[model samples]
Target: MIRALLDPSEGEPVQIERAGGRSPVILVCEHASRTIPASLSNLGVKPDTLTSHAAWDIGALATAQKISQLLDAPLVHQRFSRLVYDCNRPPEAPDAIPEMSEIHAIPGNRNLSGEARQQRVAEIYEPFRQALAALVAARTGPSRQPVIVTIHSYTRVYFGAARHRAIGLLHDRDRRLADTMLQQAEEHGITNAMRNYPYGPDDGVTHTLRLHAVQNGLLNVMIEYCSDLIDTEKGQDEWAALTTRLLEAALERFDIHAAGSQQA
Candidate 1:
């Protein structure tokens, strides 16, 4: 039998916020937490490395929470480090459990048996994926289909290259939400928004969009904020407010009610 990957003291693999909200928006922060379950021993990584962007998307959960509060949307987020299993990536993808993230080589994930791999997938990825799927399923029907809005954060500099785009609205084949948001970015005070910059569909970053949203024929977009821009509470709030406005305008274009339905 494969050993348990998470201790009882460690939290569940996924967390759902604002589950009872009435909005048709479903927010997801797959890389929300930097926590590595106690069983992994921090994946043999340095303490600082465990806290870096490799472990989680800095400030993304906070921003998503704010958006959830403002829009009264339900949010589903992963609760473990992505190094254990990137909830955004499917189980078949090798990088779902990356051995190397940027310059840091994950000693714990270097080589794994088949069972070990499946264990992570079952314990970490499935719960997060299922939670989001359930939310989408529950909100999907003839009267309303939930719009998936995934929140992510990217490093300001990667592999010694500087990234200047403050915001990235990413999409796969389905571009409805992204296109509208990009068209409304500047007017919403998001001056540095880019379409699929830093990473795009070809980069395999759209797995979550492809699996949960596109496959369900639901509208979706992956929103990426530069980590430096949202590392603090003030930044998270400001960006959340701006993103809330942008999403509101874009959703209004879709004929979805964008105001006065906010959670009290």
Candidate 2:
């Protein structure tokens, strides 16, 4: 969906997309893509940096969009580069709106005054969050909401390094959705699933899951796939079909652990 950002396009670097879904299961991709406006070309980062994890998940947007299509799920995503500001981080954290990320140095973010940070918080961050919170609040109320599934893709390696070969199923204090989804993945013979790979709910991951899931008390999990795994249409469709199967199945059997535990 096209959104409004009060800050000038200079510091304003973010986008959000949404699709309809029957379940309360909302998909969020905080570090979706890295496209710097012409005003600040490349964020002073090299081509390698753009390709690096510092920019965004290499092919996460494609996979996430595909999953959304397969499941007809609403996806709330950040359009700008994470180097500009991380939608997954709280505004208080320096990395919340990073000045430099790994190889890339964001000239726009550097020497940013308080007004500048607040400008981004008000413009890009707040709008994206408000959109998501509104979605959850609407889906849930006196009635039950569907599981909130945050979509993410991580590199097989970090900083030109290789990591363990497994897709991570991430969650924080809330595990019902992750547990159910993990069980379904394993049952399908997907043996390489990582309980929490790359990073967990901790390690400064804020915004998306914390705001849309944990704080809201929605059944939620952050699902990640290896970059190489879903880079191709064949691979993308593979994940889409398999994940949709697991999500549909788990959601069907879901007891709304968040609601029922207290309801009883």
Q: Which candidate is the best by TM-score?
A: 1
TM-score of each: 0.97, 0.85
lDDT of 2 by residue, 116-203 (tens): 6776677667777888777778778777665677777777766678876557888888887778877878787577887777788667
State the lDDT of candidate 1 residue by residue for 135-213, as single tens digits: 8888888988789999999999999999999999999999999999999899999999999977999989999999999
Off by over 4 Å in 2: 1-18, 255-264
Q: Quantify all predictions' global Cα lDDT against the true fold.
A: 0.90, 0.70
* Clashes found in each candidate (C-alpha, N, C closer than 3 A): 0, 4
Cα deviation of 245 in candidate 2 (Å)?
Answer: 1.2
lDDT of 1 at 176: 96
